[model samples]
Target chain A: MSARLRRLWGMIRKESLQILRDPSSISIAFIMPVILLLLFGYGVSLDAKNIPLGIVIEQPDTATQSLAGAFDRSEFFHPQRFGAIQEAQQALAERRIDGILWLRNDFSSRLLSGNEAPIGVFVNGVDSNQANITKGYIQGTWLAWLQHFAVAQGRALDLPVAMEQRIWFNPALSSRLFLVPGLIAIIMTMIGSLLTAMVVAREWERGTMEALMVTPLHMGEMLAGKLIPYFALGMGGMLLSVAMALYLFDVPLLSPFWLLMLCSALFMLVSLAIGLLISIVTRNQFLAGQVALVVSFLPSFLLSGFLFDIHSMPEWVQTITYLVPARYFVAILQTLFLAGPVWPVVLVNAGAMLLMLAILTVLVVKKSYKRLD
Target chain B: MSFFHILSLARKEFLALMRDKRSRIIIIVPPIIQLFIFGFAATYDLNDVPVAVYSEDRGGASRELLARIEGSPHFSILHQISSDAEIAPLIDDRKVLLVIRLGQRFSADLQRGDPAPLQLIIDGRNSNTAMTALNYLRDVVLDFNREWQHGHGQTGPPVKLEMRAWYNENLQSRWFIVPGIVGSLMLVVTLLVTALSVAREREQGTFDQLLVTPLRPVEILIGKAIPGIVIGLLEATLIIVLMVWFFEVPLRGSIPALYLGILLFLIATVGVGLMISSIAVTQQQAILGAFLFIVPAVILSGFTTPIANMPEMVQWLTYLNPLRYFLVIVRGVTLEGDGFALLFHQFWPMAIIAAVTLILAGWLFRHRMY
Candidate 1:
């Protein structure tokens, strides 16, 4: 046992020296994920307001002018006037405008006469989410205008339905709330996979693995030694991200800090195991790195519901997502950040991740033990 | 200048690649898997969002509103909360997305000629889903108002809304996304492959032999770039065809124009990858360095979200990325049916990036030792 400990400590020392020597590895380990986290957290958002809108009015009337004026005053829309619907539609297609509002002839007369006249709203529904939001703003603004007109005339209002909207968890609909937690998952995945994948593969490429294989160090000890530094690096990244989330972005860390760290540590192990397995199976640095990226980074970004909701995905795709441990980590991180942890769900996900770690660890050890000749 | 010498070197490289089955699978499976995943996964459309409704007023008007919420395919009522406090727990726990509050005076207000107020609380942390829920709620309310007014035989000035969506009329997010995915995949695969190529050869001691040969620095550069460009073009073709055939995404604009954009974009990407390959001593450094470049490329290129949504400084910084211009051109051509005239805005930027990166990579390749 003492001999094994000495050998493992030596391996750890050697690995740390190599890592410290490589300035690029150090930069990638510490700096790259932080840059990615900040960019993704602040740069990408689905909730868009102040969309530029172009309007074309064929006739100038009080009602038409008032409607255009209302749109101009709206916070959600920035209205620009165009000479022709063709020009406005061209702008819409070019992505210069969110939508175009065309006021037909006799619009004022029809409205004043209490007739059902349809207003032309040409929406580029290609992005259905934006289309839906743009439609709501237009409707809400028109309804408010009609309500104000009715109140001024002193007529009994019919169909008096009112809507009160309350947003929960995050009342302000800040993108940081949703993005920061997911950013933690993404950053951790990148750090764990990229760091471990290159480290193990580097030993093989440098012909150092053959020397280590001749020593008293077992595959398990070598793997453990490799993982220790990265585990520290992964935790460092998590804390850095958490600081940004709390102080800078203002995303609440409602769950206990220990629990958050525990989940993150477990997820880091799973990601490291995946990278180690890739490095062992491929036995070449270039192939191992590429394989690690495919299995780890892409799945974490796409299948884990980091950017898109997994529930909306097709069933076959969801089944494949179950193979990705990052999927579970993303869910766990969101629950812990937004709502305090629920034991049952957290335990189930954590258990699944533990099983994945066991499987990957076995595979990595077995692959590493094979004869190089 | 013997053909046999060139053939022998090509044969050796092909043999080496063939010996590793893992590389073959990693190279092939990911493009297909990611193409399928991105085809289905990267959509802005919200469908079958789970919502919870709480109605305090159990009158006919409230029932009609409930029916309207249920009728829309976009929302599926998951639970019904009875009290206001339940809303906080539900949204906090993610058990429900939306809570509708109908006041007790709903029926009385309808009969007494007063505007009845309804309150809707949405979990806006997931802003895309929240916005969809809000729209669905508005549509239901407007439908109810129209029916009520028609039933009473009272004609009043009807409220009309004008909506126009820009960039895409069909809201085919795939059209906007597939091109960006093409750019992203190229960034990941091409950069890593080329970045690792020379470094791995150096680690294996084959680089010294090649350097001793009469092949000029430019010849070695061409040899490295040709394989990357061929692989990049093959992957791009597979994704573009899958997007058109399987996803049913339209190819509205000129094909030559799209290819021209992709060609210019790949030039810059390959140049950067080759530059990293030349400077890196170990394969690990090459891989790590390439990754640092790829992550920022995808994020700043407007793949999952809008570039305009970013801060003005970051938005200005994205002008440096070649992929950003490619995204705009591909999405613009596919969705908007835009011609070269409208797309002229993108061409010069991509050309400039390609020229600068290529020059930098050429200089680095000559100066840096294996």
Candidate 2:
């Protein structure tokens, strides 16, 4: 047992040395996730703000000017005056302006007299998501303006219903609250899969795995040695991510820190086991890297419900998502960060992870134990 | 160089790729599976966003508001919290994405001829989806308000919004994504396949044997690029068909024009891949180097996300990416029904990228070999 411990320790040291030597592996493990997190946090926003809108009034009347003023004051619309509606329409077609708001003559008197006044809003619906969102904003702003106007004039604006919104978990609706947890899952997966994939295949390529195989190193010990260095690295990545989430992004760590770490460590183990399976099966660094991306990164990103809600997916797809370990990890991380640890969900996820780890470890060991001859 | 010898060498390379079962599966299955999954997954259109409502008013107005919310396809009412305090736990648990709070003054505000303030609390973690949800909610509320005003003989704004969604009226994300996937899949496959091709040869000492052959540098470059281009085109065709048939994404543009654009884009990508392969000493380095380039390329290419949303500096950098131009061309032709005249903006950038990257790759190939 003592001799076996020594061999495992030696293997771990060698693996750590190889990983430390490769700058790209470290960068992929650490830097890439940070960059992605920052990008997703800042750059990629679905909420369309400061949408450039062109407004053309045929004749400048009190009503047209006030309507245009209302549009100008809107947070959603950045209203610009165009000489002609044609010019604005052209801009919309060219994807320069999202929409054009046109007010015709005698717009103000119609509002005072309580008559049907027609306002034309032309929207460029090329990108339907943006177009639909912009359309809704434009329509809502106009309706609000009219309702306020009616109330000011001592009119009975019988509002049929009013919606009371209570934002629950994240009262502030801060993007950081949800994204930070998802980011942790993504970063850990990248580190665990990319590092493990490269390390084992690299050993095979460098002719070191063969030497280790011929030695007295047991398969279990060999696997442990291979995973330990990455476990440390994965933990380091989790710490960095947690710091960023807490400090930079202002995402609250609602759950117990130990629980978060425990779940993260288990997630890392599953990811590493997956990478190990890929390495042992392929025995080539390039093939292993591709397989790691296919099995780990894509599944984590797509099936894990990181961005898209799992409930929204088709039933068959939801069933298939169970195959991905990241699905469990994403749920666990989100729960840990936002909802605090609910043991039932956490336990179930942890058990799923343990089962996956067992399966992957068995496959990797079996593949590794096969004779090269 | 004799044709017979060239064919023999090509056959040898093909056999090697075939023998590597892992590489074959990695090369083939990922693109298909990723396309199918990403086709369903990468969407901004929020479907059935879980919303919880807390109504203090319980008046006719609050019920009407709830009806409007329920009417919209975007939101699915998951639960109704009895009080405002219940909202926090629900949100924290992620049981609900949106909370609609009706204040106590809801019925009185409307009776007193004042603007009844309604509050919507959205979990803004996924800002894009939140934003969309907010917009959708606001639209429903506003429409209800407008109808109420119209019934009371109040003159509202004269302008009606006529929105015509070009490319995808149903707003199927697959319509926009399929073309992008064609470009991305081709980029990954072509780049990785060739990125390792020369490097694997170098690692096996077969590259020295190739150098000893009387084949010119241009000949070797052509040989490497041809297979990659063929494979990339094949994959593109397969993905395009799958996208159109399975996902129901429409192909509005000229097929010939689309093919032409893909041809140019593949040349640029394959050139970059060949260059990486030539410089790399081992297959490991080649794959890593390809990965380093590919990740940035995919991110900057506006595949899953929009380029316009990127920072000014990153948006500027996107001009240099061949995939960016290809994406524009593909999206333009497929969705926008754009002719060559409308697509002229895309053509030159793609041509320029192809010319520059291919030239650079060829130069690097000769430089490294010599």
Candidate 3:
């Protein structure tokens, strides 16, 4: 074997053994992804269902009872009856219900007279997302009930326009289908940075870095050796995550497996290069961990369009998201998982990740060279 | 345990933390930066959802519908395609969230008083955003229907549903998310500081040195716990100030109630952190352990998503998360203007969590001392 190859092999073996010996690296690589995927898959959902809704009917009649029963029949609401509007309002305040539907005595009379009858919807809007969803659901329920009431009179309810909504990619509108795939990017980002930075920072803290520096190994070979093991470990985590997403979570993999794997490896390289750069700059392990968490982990979690929609952000924040590498990876993963290998989306995102990898690799090389000097 | 012993230990911790300029910066700086980033970035509100119009009918009906969609702030029309084939690229590339297709018979059907079929193709990849956009489109369509019905000399619809969102009338998601950043960020900072304390000392061989000191384990725990609580309170105070002043999230409730919740939350988090620290043999393990707790705590806390949406099994699991209770207290006090009575249920759970975890951490500290 060539001298350079031998030194590189030795470094890889050392890192591999350290990773095996350290329970933290193994857990971060394997167990962390499991925990994260399970939590994100089963625990977090954007679909608001079974909302506790308070219904107050001032008068007892078949019409009001039928309207209240509509709310009860819907999967989105769990309706509770209150005798008076004040009781329902109090229920809303006590957190016993998310919203209140008040029907005055005039409600049935107005409907019977064919006058404009308004139903009051009061939502606990402390959680605006839930509030908006609740408002939409209530309107839908009320409208459907109104249409049913109109049809019960043996005449057509004239609506000028009929909306035919064809929801592509995810017809069921399950948030898990998108969230589980996006989580792979986050897990890869965390494992890449945290694993490489902590391990390298430990070497520096233990003075093994100086010993390695005196060897005949080139800086590129040393960096490559440190990264190759972690690169493999991160890819392993990604594969495990993808499997869980498919089998355990039932999120479909629409695109070819190789494309997902190839793009994931590219993004993982970018993430590892970032970790290499961070560890080289902050030689202390604690400092390295902090910087990694702040720079890599938090940005990928918050700014990468993981949980939140990116286009909806303010123009400045949207501009900042372009700097986050996981943003591109998330786009690619979501496309691959949901929309198949629409080559335009996949290629553009993969190219962006490639550019990030190149830029981060250059920065890592420059910083390591500066350290050697 | 002597008061002076615990005081000296805490003083040593403060000096050790403040002595390193980087450590000082790490503690103080990242949370603030995160505050700004999360404040701006972590929102569920959809604004300017990109849409496309594919009108096969070159008539006034399509124009009227297009005009209505154009006037709305929620959607921005990025493409006006002339062909059916053009819709695929827009939706496939996610260049447009919705494609408004006006059928060739649209105006004719409307003129004949027949229902005009308006086909809307939506990218349902991000279901929440898609659902919200669909709701907005439904409103526009409903308005168009009402106007068209009135124009044709039909009576108004049977029932009008009037919605009034109580706490946040405008339904601004930032009002909901910013207050949440306070609890989650405080948890991150305090948990890391406390979780790393014992493990870091053990890694550097100072933990054994400390064990040989005159201070009891309880005194050591107090010394360790105080700095985390103090730092957490300071960090939380800074965030609450910025959340109210900088982010413009209204502080509608009593200050004392908010602080009372913050105190209990910090103690619970610090207790959890110290437990992890006592168990971890190294700083790396402490970090992994802290993260294992942090991710689930944040996700189950209903920070961005509602806990009521979660499955029943996960809902049961969320009761164990102290952040769950803290979120209710913080958002309730901040947005809902909730006082002590309304927030009573939120307080006692965190108090219990604090008591249980602190007791467990103390026992762990003593058991691990030898």
Candidate 4:
């Protein structure tokens, strides 16, 4: 082996052993991703299905019964019959049902007489997202009932204006297509920064830093030793999550796999550098871990445009999001996964990640460059 | 058996946390910063959606549609294009989310009492915003259609639905988030501190000292467990104060019930931490173990997302997660003002988790002592 290659090999051997010895490192690197992916894929969803709904028909005539019956038949809602409006109100407060549809006695008469009949829809809007979706579902079922009623009456339903909505990219509007891409960015951040944040601090805590100081190891060599193992581990994690995204969740990978792997490797390097810098600065495992979470995982989840939109935020907050590296990665992942890496988006986000890689490299080298006597 | 023995041991754990400068800051600074950051950061409001309009008809129907869209507060009409060609690039640049395209025969058809078609081309990258913006446009079109019908001396639509959101009429997201933040942040803080407790003593060579002390094994477990609960309680109290005072989210349910739920939650968390600490040889392992629990716990808890939407098996599995129950209790009290009677189903599950986990932790403590 070449002299530098020999040194690198030795470092890798040592890190591999350390990782094997510490089962938690392996757990964080491997087990954590499986758990997170399963949680995200199977557990968290914005899709509204079988939402419990309560319905009260003041007078149970054919029109009212049919209208209420339509709600019970929908794939979107599981509706229960309520005897009175007050009973439905109590159920809503207890969170037993998500919404209520109240049909008036004159529902059929008014429609036949060509007079306006108002139906009441009460939604439990405490969870604003669920409430909003429930509202849409209720309106949709009502619209379906109207069309069905018109067809049964053998009268042409006259609506002067029609809006044709064409949703580009994801026509079905599946939340998973967008959400899974963001999940990859989040999982990468967690393993990259969080796992490595304690490495150098752990060396300090174990009294190994003093022993290492006496060796003739260059700063670059030492950083490579720490980073290479975690980089490879993080990449392994990325691959696992990406596979799950493709096969398990069945989200289409429109972008080339090689290009995504390249971006993910770059993003992982930035995250690993952040972890090293934090560990070097804090030198206390407990403190370093918390700081890493503050700087890395939380920001990746919040400021990175994962769950919330960057455009919806205020101007100052938008400025802050630029500082979070995951923002660029999330943009890349979403574009690549959904829109197939339209070059302009690819160049901009990939270039920003490259900038971060340079900055974090300098930061890591500066901290590790300090002399230890 | 001695009360004073437990007190001294508890004091030592408390002082150990306070005396460490880093621990002191970890306990104090991050929670406050997270509160401010997460409060502002976690928003679901689809505010300030930028849209582009392509109106071909220079007639009254198109003009009226434009006026109605311009009036709504949710949209900022950033661009007006006379041609269809200007749209794709603007959407590609993400400069506009929705493009309102009116057909050439739009006003003519409306005048002739024939159907007019309006095309809304949406950028569905962020599906939630697209859906909300679509709903807003629908309301405008419905209103326009109704007015036109009335003006023509035609009868109004036979049936219409009136929507009202109960409890939270406006559905302000902060009402839910503030309470959720209280549960999630407290879990992390308490779990981290307790998970590191046993591992720290072993790392510092104080575990041997602790083991040789006059206190019994059960008392030692109590000493180790109490600090996490106390710290968790302190953090929970600070967050509740913020929810009530800073955010002005009303405290509707009995305040006692909320604390009772928190105490049970802390017991379950501390039990988890201690169990991990008992087996971990290093502090890093302990923290990672805590993380293993925290990540899945928070996700499964329905803190931000609803659990009912989850797969049937996953929903059943959430019964084991103490945070799931606590969140229900917390949201109940804060949003619905539900009392203990209505909240029993939430509490029993949590109490069971606490009892089972604490017992298991105590067993592990005994096994380790030997």
Candidate of highest lDDT = 3
**Weakest 10 consecutive residues of candidate 3 chain B by summed lDDT:** B361-370
Question: What is the full ranking by TM-score, best candidate first?
Answer: 3, 4, 1, 2
Query: What are the lDDT scores of the predictions, listed in order?
Result: 0.76, 0.74, 0.88, 0.83
- State which candidate, 1 or 4, has the greater lDDT: 4
Q: Every model's DockQ, to 2 decimals?
A: 0.56, 0.40, 0.78, 0.69
- Can you tell me which runs of candidate 3 are displaced by over 4 Å? A369-373
Q: What residue pairs clash in candidate 3, if any at all?
A: none
The number of clashing residue pairs in each candidate reads: 21, 23, 0, 0
Tell me how far the alpha carbon of residue A204 in candidate 4 is from the true structure, in angstroms, after superposition: 1.0
Encode model 1's per-residue lDDT on A21-128: one tens digit a residue: 867656766687678877877777766667787888988887788878888898888889998889997787677887788888877778777776567887776555
CA error at residue A361 for candidate 4, angstroms: 1.8
Better of 2 and 4 by TM-score: 4
What are the per-residue Cα lDDT tens digits for candidate 4 across B251-309?
Answer: 88877888889999999888888888887767887878787788888888888778898
TM-score, prediction 1: 0.92
How many clashing residue pairs are found in candidate 4?
A: 0
Give the per-residue lDDT of model 2 (tens digit) for B119-198. 88776545556666877786677687778667666543444455455446765655766677778778888888888888
Off by over 4 Å in 4: A1-5, A370-373, B82-85
Model no. 1, DockQ: 0.56
